[model samples]
Target: MKNEIKGCIKALGKLIFSLDDVLNEAVEFPKEHFQPCANLKTNLKLFAAALQKIDGKYMARKDECRRLMAQEEVALAKCLCHFRAGNFSMDLLQKAVTLAAVYGTRRQAKEMKREAQKIAFQYDLRSQNKNLVTDSKAKWEIMEQLMADIAHNINPADYQPEEQIAWEQILDSFEEKLREKNLDLKGMDYNSEIEELFTSAREAVVPLKLAEKLKEVAVERTKKQKTLLETLERGRE
Candidate 1:
């Protein structure tokens, strides 16, 4: 009877470890590709509830293990919520696959791998339009840097209230000029010189907007950083 009890306890311990591993992998699942749409939210809630049930079942059997497993399950649910909230970008599928490989069931790992491949294909398609991606990426980078500079309070004294107003007017004038020139930044071909010209014009206006918004509390910079980090982390998971 003593040997049988010990064997049962050992089996229960192994089962709890398996559950913990699964919870950890679930917590690290990539959010970008599997964004928590309404369906995902429901699924995650159901999974949490199921985990809680499991904890209850094991409570008397191995209270300490149950407690730890429950905590991990809850953490996994929260991570899913974060992913669904658009906290992470689609780039995190790669990380998800890696994490899944470590602790996921065969089915779960396969699903993750499939998602990673899909994301890679989408990225390849995007890259085929190299000029557009390059230009858009450049514009985004410049905007990001300008926002960061403003956030860091690095603006010059010349970028005061009056100067900011004047700068806005200047931007308005520039917009009118582009209109007169029959140039629409959004409609131009990325590979065209016209598009390059428009890009330059837009870049010229970045500093003015930075100056204007510098005095105000802008969370845009931090939000972008958070979004990017979440996206990358999701992919790496």
Candidate 2:
């Protein structure tokens, strides 16, 4: 189970990296228009449903996963501003909290909580920059902080000293590369990892009952998203 969790985290990290890369390529595309509203929302709902499925199965640390999923929805709400960019900036903050609480020791969890607070501040900064912040601290500040934040993640406090050192080095290297490319680590909290977690949980095929529950949740979220989009359009009109 431990190894499985590690693999899942790493795979999720890679997926987050890929998503950030896509956002970074926004040289010409509108920041929030990389994907159509309907498609972006559908994918997000699917991912959230997958997270819900895994949270139901994993019992342990399931609360953390649930909390993260809630935060993800909050992040997605920014997509209503389709003309703006970077609605996913708080993703790592959510993921870091979950990862620390679930897999780290007491000290690491504390560190992650601190990280979360800083990220929340960044979210405020980003918001203010949209309409309020002066030229001093703009959106780029948030991006720069995030690009640095990933490196400072506390290793699971239980790791051996050597392991912790190596992990820190890895994070440093990863962040450096992202900086070199001027990419914002905006999508670090992807829930798509839950799909793999669900598969791993069922060595046998997904249980019929669990599958049905997830399907229902997805349908409900999709409906909610449609309603939200309609409301936004109405407000525009």
Candidate 3:
């Protein structure tokens, strides 16, 4: 765990230093040469590492990624690196506000990064204690996970968001039904129809384990709901 933490921290610091350099030297920097989005996400997986034993168990975590100065949330983030904030362009500021709704404001991102650093520092201090075991099972497990993630880093962006895919599938299903029944599309509510499909999705597109878990949940929920109703009826009496 400690070893993995060290790798993560190193990665994060490298990412931060690169971003800060860009932010501080916006004029002198070459926009085409630097890749802020890729750098921020990739290097965030690295930072300084530390460890501690809490309640007789070792705990290890990476310092959260800090991309405040350079990493903008996608388009918004790109805009800052591309244009000068000192220019006071209303268009840029409006774009910033729009993107901030989803990605959070730059000020907020800065604070989050700062807070993460503080937490990381705490861990660093804990790691300084010589009592931690260097040869532990947890340490190796973390190292393995880190290596695997690096080797096969398939992020969600590799495909469309699940919600979007489901919506398209539902739309197709609805279209098929409309054509079969010779019905007008005018009174159909896609949102409600989607909800209905989800509610009755006993055969929803999911892996076997997830489907089984849902079944278990349904049975557990029904049992609890039944018990609550019986208790309520008794109280009324």
Candidate 4:
């Protein structure tokens, strides 16, 4: 029984490492890619299922260990009762001690099993939380990139009156969603907001549009700095 319990512990350790690796890889995939979402969701469900199987096995082993411990206790009690009933002999006393040792060993095994079960439960919860966070972050990153791309491609001045109104409304709706998710970009300048959205998008996957937009923003900023410097020099003269 001791050897069996040890083996179970070792197996559980390996399972934990395997699950961690699967989740890490799933989380690292690019959010803009369809494959990441599909893979992450599928793997997360599979991990949960695997955990269920491990939990079932753990419960079975625990029940068996409890039953064995209870049996040992009963046998020990019986031996004590016989000794109390004046059947005290060297043989009976030795038998009682043997039963006591078995009970002690069984109790230790139960403790180990209980500890392992606690660790497993904690790990399962951590894995579930990680899945949720990664999924949410990926979705947010994809949305951010899409919004940034739209912003970069469409100039406010080039739109017709009706198109401008409709585009603003759409942007407003998107901003509202971000607010609802507690991701506020309120009070941030256009360039700063764009940079932030780009940063968030790059957290999961780097979109080509993001790089192009960043380059454009950088050039615009440099031109503005140059104009400002020229104005200051004229003022000095």
- Report lDDT per candidate: 0.42, 0.36, 0.33, 0.37
Q: Which 10 consecutive residues of model 3 have the lowest summed lDDT?
A: 47-56
- Cα RMSD, model 2: 20.3
Which ranges of candidate 4 are over 4 A from the true structure? 1-63, 102-237
lDDT of 1: 0.42
Worst 10 residues of 4 by lDDT: 156-165
Q: What is the Cα-based TM-score of model 4?
A: 0.19
Candidate 3 ranges beyond 4 A from true positions? 20-171, 174-193, 198-237
TM-score of each: 0.29, 0.21, 0.24, 0.19
Best by lDDT: 1
Tell me the spans in candidate 2 whose CA falls farther than 4 Å from its real position.
Answer: 1-73, 76-198, 202-206
lDDT of 4 by residue, 1-237 (tens): 445555434443343345443233222112231112233223223323322332333333432132223323434433333322222333434455564433333443344345334534544423533321122333334333443333333321122112111223334455555676677443333354555544553433434565665668747745854654454345435
| Maximum-TM-score candidate | 1
Which candidate do you rate higher for lDDT, 2 or 4? 4
Q: After superposition, how far is residue 81 of candidate 3 from its true place, in Å?
A: 21
2 or 3, which is superior by TM-score? 3
**lDDT-best of 1 and 4:** 1
TM-score of 2: 0.21
lDDT per residue (tens digit) for residues 1-237 in model 1: 344435444543564457664554342333343454433224334433434443444454432223333333433333333334322333344445654554455676687678556645655633544312222332233223332332133221111223222223333444466678785444234344544554455456557566566535346544643554454345434
